[model samples]
Target: ILHSQISTIEKQATTATGCPLLVRCKNFQLLQLVIPQERDCHDVYISLLRLARPVKYEELYCFSFNPKLDREEREQGWMLIDLSEEYKRMGLPNNYWQLSDVNRDYRVCDSYPTQLYVPKSATAHIIVGSSKFRSRRRFPALSYYYKDNHASVCRSSQPLSGFSARCLEDEQMLQAIRKASPGSDFIYVVDTRPKVGVTTLVCVFAAPSHGMRDEAMLPDPLREPHLQGGFAQPCMAALLSCLLGPRSSWRA
Candidate 1:
């Protein structure tokens, strides 16, 4: 690590989480630092940056030198993701969509997580029936709901029916999903499944009232998604693009 010993300049003043820093060398070396003091932490971090990249004299090095940070009102790291807090940010449990623990015990869908957020228009019967029709009972569920346009990102496994088969209840549930997002004129499908799977979703997800768009082929995912307020992981860029559209800036 770059600053492993942590030059204990101040014994009294110490960071709550013990100021940790990571530096990646060009030779594939990852160095870590845990400066205890606030001033020392800042000093060590800046020193590391300067060491990595030298600057000219009187150039105001710190002016346009911005560093990425993850923080809140309090100091913490590797925090557990709170589902309620996350959904609250999305402005859920409104007239259109609601949170249901119907699958709390994972009885309806073993693969799906508890606390299902779905369209309020969908009935209990419709959900149960939809589960039965889907592969591994992984029925359609909302992944993200855009507050700006009220556009949603719903995910689901392939329907059990390959192409010819159809499920009335499954169709009804998907129809309710469209009604929940009134802002969008079209229901864009981002299918990562094979040809038969993609074709199956199109066959079942298509409704009479809503237009269907097959965006199965996702755009090249950005290498650094966090630059534009996107998903932290680069792989998720494809899903984010498909859900939010090509010209989207959905904050993580």
Candidate 2:
């Protein structure tokens, strides 16, 4: 193993975490600055997850940037090159790598300069029933949209219809996650009153499946989520109770 010592500075201003010097370095030549970013920017990537019950596949969409995007596409913004070939290109030895369900209609071309667009519906259900079983899961690290709050019943502004109605009635705290994240739809039309049981909800965003850090900065559960408005106490307690509740009890 290579061994080296980190050089120390005599004086420096500390960050909120109270560490002296904003940048951390491994050696004289290697410098690192850890900028604080939003939590959702990190949390969406998952390798495996155990659900309470069986889950059905829903429409899946992936947002990506194509460095070789054409001029026409570039004129609009970033491009989404089909990454169905990712497993092949990555050269993983497992056959399961190629089993990605990339169905037709699940693709989209994002214009460049802009690196965001809604892809076709995914063929998998990201979340499912019973809360008793485990399943592998994968989602993009970054899901860019024009605004945040698309998942909020109050912010979506859609008429009381199919998707909108479900969003309103769903009691799952995770339901509103995508909307409060960065780069989601800005306007929310549904009401948050029914879901306002918690005054504050803390959401922790971990690094990717490859792992980035032991812990990422998590938002205060008592405060409003990053992009959405503040949460209420009752709501917070209810959600926490569910998360911390006895697992076996649910089944019993």
Candidate 3:
């Protein structure tokens, strides 16, 4: 009986026998109720209507409420994956890539995690300077390192580039990335999106005239649809093809 599920409430009629109330839910669940008493049906409808639409701002969502925390409770789930342990598995702190503490104070990139792994050639000064070139101060940071080839998959926000926007440090950073992966001449940029509307999902209300009027109710219209197939899907076929190629140990 979640009020959020309620979409459209239709009052059929209030005859002598009873009142037929039709409730269409967000999930397209058609709820047809025939209340025996006319007054009770009106009361129920009014109650449901009030509950569905909260008048107060805070009543909209339960995010304001804070549950009591157990002082004695100690959860060890957070300690499962220590930074050092993960780096150890990757065989890092080598010649190609090294651990970076430039963002330890979170001054360089507030959006990024405090801990970061950058190219070995790029110094702390270069890392700090390069942040200005990229969006949200998200400078290129190592996400994965292929042990065999010293190849790395660096993640970064879009570069703040325009006609005149340029940074020498950012250029040096790219060079450092290239240097890390020896024998590799060029870097390939892969766009995950297939096309404009092939894999694109629009909001239910965004394009009312686009699709059929009585279309299937989408549960999560806001959430970006998971890429089952894309032109250049990141972290998988696109990046791995450049690194592993058609024939590799990772082949299924």
Best by lDDT: 3
Q: Give the TM-score of candidate 2.
A: 0.16
Candidate 2 runs further than 4 Å off: 1-231, 246-252
lDDT per residue (tens digit) for residues 34-90 in model 2: 324323212211111111111322311122224586769676643455433332343
lDDT (0 to 1) per candidate: 0.63, 0.26, 0.67
Residue 33's lDDT in candidate 1: 65
- Candidate 1's C-alpha runs over 4 A off are 1-79, 161-164, 195-252
Candidate 2, residue 161: the lDDT equals: 15
**Clashing residue pairs, candidate 3?**
none
**Candidate 1 residue lDDT tens string, 44-89:** 7777555445454234454444457644622344357777788889
| Best prediction by TM-score | 3
Residue 209 local lDDT, model 3: 35
Which consecutive 10 residues in model 2 have the weakest lDDT in total? 45-54
**Position 246, candidate 3: lDDT:** 53
Clashes of 3: 0
